[model samples]
Target chain A: MELADEAIRLADLPAADRRTIMILGHEASGIPSEALDLLDRAVEIPMVGTGHSLNVAVAGSLVLYKLAGLL
Target chain B: MELADEAIRLADLPAADRRTIMILGHEASGIPSEALDLLDRAVEIPMVGTGHSLNVAVAGSLVLYKLAGLL
Candidate 1:
């Protein structure tokens, strides 16, 4: 719970209080700019590796687990 | 924390008391038989969808986060 002020961990989110929706972008180009206009917030998985990004399915799965309080 | 009695969740492991190692298998074939001979336990992610399995990298990443107590 002592994370940086801006870092909102998925595990710490109030999953029971509200419905959650996740939008995963294309691994290479990411979500189109227009789609970005409809989202309420952005959530990013913290990574420290050299890979440019995680596979889109993997990213989506992780978020789903976190939002579902399964992780 | 009231998971199935047979389930030993990564989050419930005593991470602070011991070192943890994770071995990821090939995406298609999975870990070799010889390699399986050495591991002490098998952990599986519960899934409900029609996909046969998760992307290997995603599976590995999820385990790492759980073991690291970051999930």
Candidate 2:
């Protein structure tokens, strides 16, 4: 996946603001070379089940809430 | 939660278009009357773990993909 492209497209926000953005995925290290330059941070959530990833919005919400000090 | 408000705010789209939208949550039946009028559909996903819900984006992606006949 073009994670940076997805992030940029989905956010539709300014690049300066994108610095605060965090991209979390199961395969963070596997992200394409093109996306590395765009991501501010890439996080991987540890999972125990066969299901290895959390939904993007759920991950986004967790990070947002943590950054906002809500969780 | 003001689900309708959240959906409206997040979608940033037109009302007519929102009719095609579906709001999925663990507590679908508990949605407020205000939201019932706004949502095109409400879905609930069965869970096996303490975690009772999928992230909204994951849920959204699933629904979107299903609607697009991709899954």
Candidate 3:
């Protein structure tokens, strides 16, 4: 899934055992509309900082680690 | 701690309650020797991919989330 505000928290995803594919888009604009349409769900990483969001790479890795149950 | 071959796993760190400060440096060279001298330990995020290492932002964010115990 892609990152979005209304999406579920990455931590709240059902289980780590299920294979998953994560789509990370541009840091500023996010995934293209066409690509987003192909995905079934989106996930968000809750942040308390003033920054707009975490870097794309950082966001992607965090999701991967969480989905892998490594973090 | 910085990323290193012999460092402990970020997940293996003692507890999430401790306050921690993470220093992330250039993706290619890593934390400079001067800064490395001041750090007491290092932690690693094991990878199964062929990539040499993760992007600096990704690595840093992962560490931060782990330290925060939010992952």
The top-ranked prediction according to lDDT is 3
Interface RMSD of 2: 14.2
Which pairs, if any, clash in model 1? none
Where's the lowest-lDDT run of ten residues in candidate 2 chain B? Answer: B9-18
- For model 1, chain A alone compared with the true chain A gives a TM-score of 0.67
Docking class of 1: acceptable
Q: After superposition, how far is residue B29 of candidate 3 from its true place, in Å?
A: 6.7
Error of 2 at B39 (Å): 3.7
Candidate 1 whole-model C-alpha lDDT, 0 to 1: 0.61
Clashing pairs in 2: none
After superposition, the stretches of candidate 1 with alpha carbons farther than 4 Å from their true spots are A1-7, A14-20, A26-34, B1-7, B10-19, B25-41
Worst 10 residues of 2 chain A by lDDT: A8-17
Ranking, DockQ, top scorer first: 3, 1, 2
lDDT of 1 by residue, B1-71 (tens): 11223446544543334676777776566667676667665565666569877767777777876766656
Please write out the lDDT profile of model 2 over residues B1-71, one tens digit for every residue.
Answer: 23443343222232233336565544444566775676654443333348645565655554453343322
- lDDT at A29, model 1: 63
TM-score for every candidate vs. truth? 0.61, 0.32, 0.66
Every candidate's lDDT: 0.61, 0.44, 0.71
The DockQ values of the predictions, listed in order, are: 0.47, 0.08, 0.52
Which stretches of candidate 3 lie above 4 Å from their native place?
A: A1-6, A14-18, A25-41, B1-6, B14-19, B25-40
Better of 1 and 3 by lDDT: 3
The predicted structure with the larger DockQ, 2 or 3, is: 3
- Model 2, A19-51: lDDT tens digits are 365545444445666666676644433333496
Q: CA lDDT of A30 in candidate 1? A: 63
